[model samples]
Target: MHPGIIFFLVILGSVLFHIFTPWYWTDIASNWGGMDDTITLTFWIGGGVFIAVCLFMIYCVLKFSYKKDRKVEYKPEDKKLEKILTWATTIGVAALLAPGLIIWNQYVSVPKNALEIDVMAWQWGWQYRLPGEDGKLGTTQVININDDNPFGINLDDPYGQDDVLIQSDLINLETNQPVKILLRSVDVLHNWYVPQFRAKMDAVPGIVTYYWFEPNKIGEYEVLCAEYCGIGHYAMRGGVEVQSSIDYKKWLSEQETFKELIAKQQKIEFGNKKIVKNNNFLLNKEIYKEE
Candidate 1:
């Protein structure tokens, strides 16, 4: 059999495998269905190009292979073919990129009413923080993370007093609510990713990165770290539960707050329950100096 026949068989098998493959995207539970559409568009464009190129190669192989019956014809510089190939390649690339750019614009542009939630990642686990009734999260510092103060929330900041803290692996989100997740890291690089939500972002040390998604379905989803940070990277996983507004609020009310954690920390560290220098991180501010 000619090599062209073998190549044709391989292409056919690949196409069949892709079509019958059970591995594909999980069911989307977030408002990022547009992301799925954009990805599908990419797959279509790529597949078309792959098949077209393979067919062209096969045609060339079978038609131009050295044959004693046919004299060798040396032909180069087909301007018409060159123009067609150039235009085709340009159009394919543009089609592939345009949708992603459009989707990316929407991705970074957080909705005006989207709730701001903080996600802190470490080498091995996940933590979450949400504003209390004040609707504002307190400022945080890397220097403040300790046994009792795991979130590194600035205790001096009033807004963070009511910030709800979830030091557990499971979290609950309100259905149909758009949320802008603020990603942070204290140790090394990590990522906060939930496949069903169709959004993920990196957690870089000394800085914050973010992505947003709205959970439209009331279901549980597994969250995974998409980046490798260390040996524990594979086990750095969590979960999210999308629930009704009432149920979500109930869950939120049960979580501990930063101020509460500080108070508990005070009791544990100081057996007699005492207070100490409170402005370790905030004393340098001019406003505090004047006060």
Candidate 2:
């Protein structure tokens, strides 16, 4: 019936449950395993504090319970205790914040050899652009966007002509190669996240964001939008397949270039116009004969 005993039991149960829980992180396939280390460090710091505070409360409850004949000591404050608490709190906070800062620095620093890829997110789907043999992504703007040119890649920019466009959600990358992913959003705000890679960044409507990672293992990773956007937000899913260099190259080679896509669209429109002109001519000739 004692409150102290119940507190002890609660702490014990929590520790046991955490130790025996089957839920753990997925296998990391990228070079950002340091992220896992940072998380573990945070868990230890937070969990340790929880356990210590609860145990201390239980001790006070048991030791100070209903002393019928004892007089309570009225000590205002302890200067030494205050100093110790202040320094301890400061150190704990710094420990938690320092690793995250270090990781963020590395996350934003792209290597010179890192291959650049553009990821565009919309309300219900994802699109990608890869630089062609030139290894440079073309300039893009929101004003140039249309049904035919979804990426809004500049038509007048010669550099954009050979940019490879992937209309589908699937993307392929070479294993053990570093890549810098540029994130953009057309309709609403979204986040490009893959758990196995342990890297994610937001795609804002007006500005571009980016993160870098190297897939050291060959596997397929599922991509999900971490931010809530609209009704189809739950269905907005995609994938990334890391493969050998040869297979990656083969897949890239099959993708359509920006210029090729524009030309194809023009041809289809031209054919439709010709058909309409022929139909009008036939109708006019028939009316003239009747008259």
Q: In candidate 1, residue 148 scores what lDDT? A: 74
Q: TM-score per candidate, in order?
A: 0.90, 0.97
lDDT of 2 at 169: 88
Which number leads on TM-score?
Answer: 2
Candidate 1: list runs displaced more than 4 Å. 272-291
Which residue pairs in candidate 1 collide?
Answer: none
lDDT of each: 0.89, 0.94
Best by lDDT: 2
Candidate 2 lDDT trough over 10 residues, lowest sum: 16-25
Listed per candidate, the RMSD to the true structure in angstroms reads 8.7, 1.1
